[model samples]
Every structure is written in structure tokens, then in C-alpha cells.
Target chain A: MTETPTSSHFKENAHAALHDAPLQKALQHVRVNFIDKRAKAVARLPEFEALRDSARDIKDHTLANLDLYIEAYEARVVAAGGHVHYAMTAKDGVDIVLKLCHERGAKAVTKGKSMIAEEMGLNAALEAAGIDPIETDLGEYIIQLRGEAPSHIIAPAVHLNKEQVEADFRRVHRDLPSDRDLSQPVQLLTEARGILRDKFLSADIGVTGANFLIAETGTSIIVTNEGNGDLTQILPKVHIVLASLEKIVPTLEDASQLLRVLARSATGQDMSVYTTLSTGPRRPGDPDGPEEYHVILIDNGRSSMLGGDFEDMLRCIRCGACMNHCPIYHAVGGHAYGSVYPGPMGAVLTPSLIGVEEGGQLPNASTFCGRCEAVCPVRIPLPNMMRHWREREFERHLSPKAMRYGIGFWAFFAKRPTLYRLSTNVAMRALHWLGRAKGRFASLPFAGGWTRYRDLPAPQGATFQSQWRAKSGSVH
Target chain B: MSAREEILANIRRSLGVTGAEAPRRMAVDDRLAQARSGIIPQRGQGDQAARVATFKDEAERAQASVVEVETAADAPGEIARFLRDSNLPATLRMGDDPRLAAMPWSATALDTAHGASDGHDLNAVSAAFAAIAESGTLALVSGPDNPTTLNFLPDNHFVVVAASDIVGDYESVWRKLRGGYGKGAMPRTVNFITGPSRSADIEQTLLLGAHGPRRLHIVIVKGA
Candidate 1:
């Protein structure tokens, strides 16, 4: 069913992704783009690294007293004349939104890009309940039209080319004259803008995600470059902010601290174009704003992640920087991970939210290059958390049989240094002689997983220990 | 248990807390009460002239057009000149900001309307509550005085701020906000707008004007 939900088939998904021609072409844009831009932006701000530490400490302090802060945050929200709902599960989150829509008799709802909505599968739920939910983010709108999951957290349709988007626009907007020029990305954006403008004006309910929930003033802040989140929230009669629990910050200043690093690490902008801090609803005498405001604080297993090995993940601002810097993500793209999130952050977080059984393979897919941790705004030790997940997977016997037995066999020799050295030395000598002609192995028994896509360089008849000893334990 | 109670209870259970710890409550209360502004960069710290220079420089870097005038009276003529030079319509929409209402709009042959934008305006202008020099951000608080829609719904947006209102960092803006709205309170909406709207979602090719203003023009009045 649905091809076994690709996360469980991560290896196969990655294999298929490697062979995908168009996706490969589309992924080339990501490799040379975000890395250079983020480096440039981070270079301009000398205090960027220090700001990252401050951001990290802010999240750490808030999370340590998360219960009390949440209580205080809720109190401020109520005092500001807004309503806050807590959803312990994803279904409860969806049900809460559905109830709001039903109460409002909503015929149409406009939405900003929100990973939490993706987690709750809120769009499908609303559609099943006979309410139309329209995605307003240009990237999200494209993926939504194709009925596909997002490939990247920030750039949701990053795995698509201009040609593919043109085709999608042609198929969906059949009423548009076939002769009209849709040759460029800007034209597609313009067409979407014209169509969504009416949707924004007429929608009965609007749902958006909060970049941060400021506890001091009971504010839900949204940072966007397109200004779509503002249009989605302000035009409608009702505005709903769907945020996970750990998005809370103690004060406006903490939000500001995180904002400095968030945009820099995510999109390389000193500031996103629009950072709207909305508190409560429209006040009396205020013109052109939502009348009712609601915030659904969804836990969905995040509360359970607190005080665990994966607790550092709670500090994630969802800046998508970890994925941007991940090498494995560069290879396979986000859809291959097939979780709500992808890349290094997903590798550790998916198993925590869903389960180790369903999402265990994601953590194994990493090369552990540590790029994700290096670029994280809050400095999440992503590789360390993935190692913990690997331990959990191994303890549960969820890893492959060859891996279990192979590590076990290696451990037996590893425990005895003499035997380990003897076996490795003999094996190296045999392989060096066999591969002396080509100086490499194109294929080998029990190494298909490696050599299938890349070649392996041969050793030169010496174990690493011997080379280290000969070189006096120094390496260039 | 209610969803709120159960969720909070689970968070307490996971952290091995009873939700009644005095030290935890005190820490949260103190942090909220005395909001600490951390790591304001040196780039934005300066005197009035330096602050204006940085604000103009950073605003231009973010692709916003900035112009300085001698007085609040000179802003209207400059705006009219800018619209004419850009070959835009000589019409503008604005909010009930008294500073803008007092501008000598009749000095130029421009037609301006007052009130919120209903998503059908070509250009709109609003007075900033304050401006930040760090990233050239204009803080617009929502009220009858200035609707938030005017900041986002226009094709071209013009914001007028006094030079003295320019702050060094967002922390200074927060201080001004607390001074205006009191502690633990805020207006319905506060938008920190850096530039015109943009999106790189389409194949990561950056395009200006996805849904908000395609162009943002800031007029800094020196002697207001």
C-alpha cells in the first residue's frame, strides 16, 4: 500500500532517487546554492557563532522549565483574549482543527506552509470533512497540486525543475489559454499569485505555523519572504496557528536572538521579508484583520522526547539548515526519507515521533560527516543523536542481519588485538596482490551495497596499524 | 484528563518534575519579567548619523530603496518624485497615522486615499513605529492608526520614519514597544518588514514580489 511508505524502504527509495534523471537535475541547484549563500551570510555577521550559542542557551533554558513556561505562555494568551488548545497526538490536532472549521462553517481555508499541518495530515482531513484547504506557499502549492509530499523543509518542491512546474501549471490551469507564455519561473509565480489572491480574500478560515510562540506577550510570530502567511491569517475571519510545543521562547528578546541566526542559517537573509508578530485577534476599531485567533499547541510525541537522548532535537527552530548542509540529503533528496522531515534532523527525529520500527532506517542512512551539526543554528548534535537511535535500533534487533552478525564477528576479533591484526594483515596482503593490476575493486562478494554505485580503492598490502607505526603515528 | 492537562503532565513526567518546583517557576518568571537582549551586533551600534547610514546601507542591501529628506514636509514631494520617476500611478493609500495626515500632500499633484488596503492597491504608505538599524527593519504596529494590510497588500510600499525613531537593534525596538504598549502586552500585529516580498521556492531562483509588495521604498525624515 502506497509503496510501503518509503521511509521503511529507505535504501530502495535512495536507489530509485539516484536513478531519477529529472530529480538529479533538480538536485544540482541545491548543491551549489544554499551552501555558498549561507556561508556568505554567516560571514557578514561576525557575531553569528556567538548568536548561535545564545540561541542554543535560550532554547535550553526554556525547555528545562518547559512546563512552567507553557503554563505562563497559556496564561498570557488567555489574558490577551486568545484561545489555546493542546493536542497530545497528531489525530487530536487534526480533530481540533476540524472542530474549529465545523464550528465556523468554513467552506474554504487558506494555509501557510507548516510542517505540523503535514504531520497532522490536516489538508486531507479537512478535505474528507468537505472543507477545502488551499496551500498558499508557492513551493507547498506546487507539491500540493501534484499530491506529493514536500522534498525539502524550507523549499518544499526543491526536487522539481522549471519544466516540471510548467507542466503542472498547464495541467491544473486548463482554462488558461495554451498560447500564453509560461517559459519562466516568474510567470508561474504570477499565475499562482493571481489565483491565490482571490482565495485569500474569500477564505473563511486561515491556518499558519508559528516560527516562535513568544511567551512574554502571548505572540505567535511568522517569518516569511512571500508575505503569504500574513495574507492567509489577516484576511480571514478566523486564524489558527498550529505549532509544536517546543517552539515556545520565554520573551520577545529570545525570539529576536533566535531570529538573527534562524534566517541567516536557513535562507541566508539578514531578515526574512516579513516577520509578523500576531497576538490574539483583531481589536475593536481595527480594520482588516482576523476576528478570532486560535493556537493549537500540538505535542505529537515531542513532550515524550524531553529529557531523553533526543531532547536536543526539541531546540530545533525548523530552519532547515541541517538538511541544507547534509551530504546524504544532497544525494537522495527529501522525499526519499519519506518522513515529515528529511535529512539529518529527520534521521534522528522521525524515529522519535513515529517509532524506531518505521523510521529506524533513516538514521542508518547518514554518512555521519557532521555537517548538519556544524550548521545548526541551535547547535543540535545531530550525529550524536543518530548514534543513539542506532543503538536503540540495534538493541531492538531492528537492523539488518548481515549488519548484526558482521559487527558481532568484527567485535570478536576486535576484542583480541593480536588476532584482529593478524586477520586484517593477511586479508590486506591477499587483496593487494589480487588487485595489483587495477589497484581497485569494481565489485566484491558482500560488498555489492558499496560497489554498486561507486568503486573502492585497494589497500597497498599494509594494515593501518603498520602504516601508523612506520610513520611514527603521524598523518598528513 | 483534558488534552492540556495530559500534555503538561506528560512533559512533567518525562522531565521528572511535579510542575510545582519553586526554582523552575522563579527562573521562568524572572526571564519573562526581565527579558534579556543577547548579542546585538556592533554593526548597528552608532550615533544618529551612523545609525541612519547603517540603516540606509542595510536596507539597500536587502533590496529596499531608501531616501532621506530634510523634514517631514519634504517627504511627500520626494514620494511623488519617486513614483513619477518609476513610471507608477500617482495614487497612494495610507493609514490614519497623524504624522502622514499632516504631510503636505497637496503640494504635489498626487491623489492619496486614507484607510486600510483591501488587496486592490498599487501603492501604500504607513508610518513606522520605529526603525532598526541592524537589518534596516521597519516596525509597524497594527491599530486604527496603521493597518497591517497596508504593509503587505500593496504592489509598492512606502514607509516614513523619523530619523530619531531609528534604533540600533531589535532589543531597542522591544524597549520602545514596551514603553508604548506596557509590559506583557502588544498590539494586534507588529510587522518587522525588511524589504519587499520575495520567494526562492521555484527551483531556488529568487524572485521579488510573490504576494507582497514588489518594491519597498523608505523615506527617512530628518527634522520631523
Candidate 2:
């Protein structure tokens, strides 16, 4: 995790990503793989849609009574022989973790993939504190080697091909033979598995993120396709779960409702290979499990999201279906978004977490395709929240001067019907006559943004209003 | 104020609620106590035979090999034959589960080791607490009976699930947990495993056996 977010320069980053040959080639895998798998998985279960509605209701109930749930959840954790630490900010969360690591005299820590850690820059903070943080997830390990952020939430190395990973392994694992046949993906996987196994055994502290925290059972659950998260939590003497306070559900049954849709929407599996529920430290007679359990509940601006316009965004399970189906995300890839999260969900969430001024460029990244809403298991209305962000940006004058001026100009004509019709009528005929030769605008004044990428069709002699009026009687 | 109090205060403020509201507290208490289940898929419903069939089909679809045995005593020989056929090692590690301990391991020539693994073992087996047919998931709880380490550390994993323990959905397994472990008290770990470990991290080309068990073999015991 890094402290800097290049979200303000999203336009420039996108510009660079559009032309990056290797990145464009890598993004093809995402466009082809995730969407089809999720579709097939959803089609198999008739209860999938009903389960989604149930999941949404469960989250909405929990959020409304969040304070009480947190109280109950804390009581359970404390009773189950685990410690609960509350962090009001990401910095506080990092300090809490660092303190815990220092208390244990930890040198090496094996970490499962956690977006909360990515948001808080936990790895960099750990490294700065002279602790080695080893990423256990194959995708996470690959990205960590390249010193890059994850392009997709679930598929962190989706922006990389097998060749990039092969090179990274060869560069870092210098002790291995140079002529090793790392041609296939499986060979690369096997190589990383062998390397990480030793680290898993040696690491003193294991860190992971929880998909859900059940208040009734006092359990923190992780749903992973790979069993890395389980190994990370189970092996070490100290297991630390880094989670947001909003992840709590009231009961195991409620978690079941959410779990039903989680894997299908994310990886298109009936169930992920491993869905582990870790309650607390090991029992008295238990042989091989963590000796201590700790949960760092980080708020980092999510509490204020309650009862607000962006409250629905809190319902997201981070399944990554939104990005998989996004047209803009397909074109530019995740690095271009310049945030830990990418795609439509990121567009709404980044602004909330990082402030509208820095992350305002992201909300405008959507084409309003609405596939994200349709496919969302909990049914978060992403496009509407992006619209809310746009309004906030416009009101605060955080949007570009040209966009503001253009919107203002349109608003002026929009308010007065007579003037609007008159201007549109005159402008339409002029454009019709001027562009009659080519019949399209390859380049135009004040429309460079649109025409630069693709041509805008010229007006067909008359405006839509005039054409509508002429066809009104006959059509009726 | 302490961090916990401050965070709680912030949440209550945003939610426009007093922390001690009676109705809200009641609602939360009722929800937790009731622990009502939501939608459950109908595919895995019916008698034990139907559930076992659905479980096998779904498990195989997830790339886990499943075999049926008439009794718990028959599991070891079947697993040994599977190991011999697959060209795997004759040795395997496991935890000290009583059901597995009751099995006649000496009947077969397969060398069996007990206790938790330290990552050197190639293959291991554990008796599952329950199995869900909806997604072909085996629910294994953690303790000395069947240590959680045996589930993840080894390259190859064999889980012996009871046919009677196979339920139609995840909710059924939750009820069984409540019945067995008591309300609000559960094992340190309950792992629901569906297939062998796999990763699509490298260019979305899925390759099994990333970090956990490379091969997951399930043996369903029909009856006592």
C-alpha cells in the first residue's frame, strides 16, 4: 500500500494507459473471463436473485443498528478471548497494528489480500517500521514484487501477463536456476507456492481481511478461492484481522444469505474453494492454531456514510462484478484510475474515502451503462451515487472550469424554452449546411474532448424537437 | 474520549440515534437470538440419497474427486487404492479424530501419521463435521479431533464426510452447529471447502494447487 493516489490526474493516467501496449493486451483477460463465468454461475441457481434481496435487507438492517451491533460484536470478541481495537483513522489503525507487531517482536508477517490494508498503506508502514510483510495470495504476491497496485480487487495481477510474473520471479528469486522453464502459468504458480510456504511457516504474525464478522457467533469469516487466508490466520502465533466496522452481520444465518451470492458474483463458483470462519484464538487443547487473535476495526470515514446519499455503497461485498462489466474499465484498465479500487464502485467510494477534490475525476469515468447495478448481488445503485458525486463536485466548483462553463451554458438555454428552441434550430441548420460534405464532425470547437476520440454525427437538417412536432400527429 | 467511545459516538451521530434506544436494541437482540435463515436453494433438497448425489455432482464439477464407501471402515482401503492408482506416496498425515482412529489403518499397507502437519507432509485426511450439498462444501471444525492445520498445509487432502451429515444448504449446517456447539459458541475454525486450491492470478489462466491442497479427494461414508 502507498500513501499517494494519482486520482486527480486520472485523465493523464488514462491517456497513458490507453496507449500502453502490454497493459491493453493484459486487460483482454478480464474482459473475456469474469463476465461469462459469473453469468453461468448465476443462471444455475434459481434462488440467487432472492438471496440477493435477502442480502441487501440484512446489510440495511445492520447499518441502521450499527452502533448496537458493534457493541454486541465487541462483547463477543472480548468474551471469545480476542482483543478488539478501534481505529478512528487509517493512521491510527496502522499505529495499532504496528504496536501489536512490536509487542510480539515480529519480524516477518504473512498477509492475506486486504483492501482495507491497501487503503491504509499498511505494507509500507510495516516496512518503514522494519518488519517484512509477505503477501500470500498469488495475485497479491505478484503485484507486491512488481511494486504496483492491484488493477482489479479480486484479480490483483489482472493487468499483468504470465511473462511479467515470470520475469519478476526470476529477478527476485536469484538463487534459482536462470534457465528454469517458467513458460506456463502452472510452473510460475508452483514456483511461488514453494517460495511462500517457507514464509508461511516462518512468519510470526498473520494478517487477513474479513468478508463478514458475525456478531452472534463472534466469528470473522474470510471467503477465498485460494486457501492462503486460512493458512495465514491458522499457522502463526498471532492472527490479526483487519476489517472495517461496517462488515458486521447479526447472525450466521445472515452471513449464509450473503455468502450464497458472494462467490457466484465474484469468481462464478458455486462456492469458493475455502470459506473459513475463525472465531478467536485456539482452545486450550487445540494443537495448531493461532495463540492470539486481534481485530482492528478501522472507520476511516465510513461511519459518516451512514444515513447519507452514499449509504448504499456500504452494502458492497467487494465481489468485483461491477468492474468486470464496466465499459470504461475495459478501455483504460485499473492503473489508470490511480486508486486502490477501480471501476464504478471505485468511482463512488474513492471520493468518499479520499475527499471529492482529489477523487472527483473518477465519478465521471462511468458511461452509465447500469450493468453494475443489474449484476450487483446486493443491488447497490452505483450510477445514481456517481451522479450525486458529480453534483457535489459541481457545487463545490471542483470540476474543471471548462466543464462548469459548458454545463452553465447549457443550463441557461435549458431554462427558457423559446430561446432554447431558437438557438438549437439556428445551430442545427448551420451545422447541417457546413458539415453536409463530410456529414460528420472530425474536429469541432468546444467539442474537442468528444471528437478527439471519435467522430460526432452532424445534425440531419433539423432538431429532434422539430422532427418530433412534425411526426406527432401521424405517430399518435 | 477513548477510540472506541469516539468511534461509537461518531456512528450514533451520523445515524441520528441515541445509543440506548430501546426499539433498536430490541430489534438487534431479536435478530441475533432468532437467527432466522433466508433463501436456500432447492437443488439439493430431498432424501439422503438425493443430497449425496447432488453433493457428488457439485463436488466433481468443482474438480474435487468423490467416492462412496459403505461404511467408515471401508474409507482407508478406498483411499489407499486411490493413492496407489494416482501414483501418490503411500504415506499420509491426519489429526487424532476418534472416528478416524477407530478405522483399521493397519489393514492396508498405507503409512498413516497423526497430529498436526508442519508443512513437510504431501497428503493428509480429516473427518468433516458436516457436508453441504448445495455447493458440495465440507464443513470441518477446528480442535484436537481434527486440527485445522491438516486441511491447508498438505499438498493433497482427503476428507471423509458422513452421508448422514450432508445437508441441503449452508443454513442447515448452521443449525447443526448451533445444536452441537450451543448458541453463540462455536469452534475456533469452521472451514467450508469445495474444491482443491486453485488460482487464476496469472493472466486469468486457472492453475490448481496454488498454496493449499493440490488435489482434494472426498470419501462419503454411507452408514455405520
Please list the C-alpha lDDT of all candidates, in the order they appear: 0.92, 0.93
Best by lDDT: 2
Q: Please give the TM-score that candidate 2 achieves against the real structure.
A: 0.99
**DockQ result, candidate 1:** 0.87
TM of each candidate vs. truth: 0.97, 0.99
DockQ for candidate 2, C-alpha atoms: 0.91
Reference contact recovery of candidate 2? 0.93
List ranges where model 1 is wrong by over 4 Å. Answer: A1-4, A436-442, A451-458, A467-476
What residue runs in model 2 are displaced by over 4 Å at the alpha carbon?
Answer: A473-476
lDDT of 2 at B65: 98
Q: In terms of docking quality, how is candidate 1 classified?
A: high
- lDDT per residue for candidate 2 within A99-200, as digits (tens), equals 999999999999999999999999999999999999999999999998888889999999998898899999999999999999999999999999999999
DockQ of each: 0.87, 0.91
Error of 1 at B80 (Å): 1.4
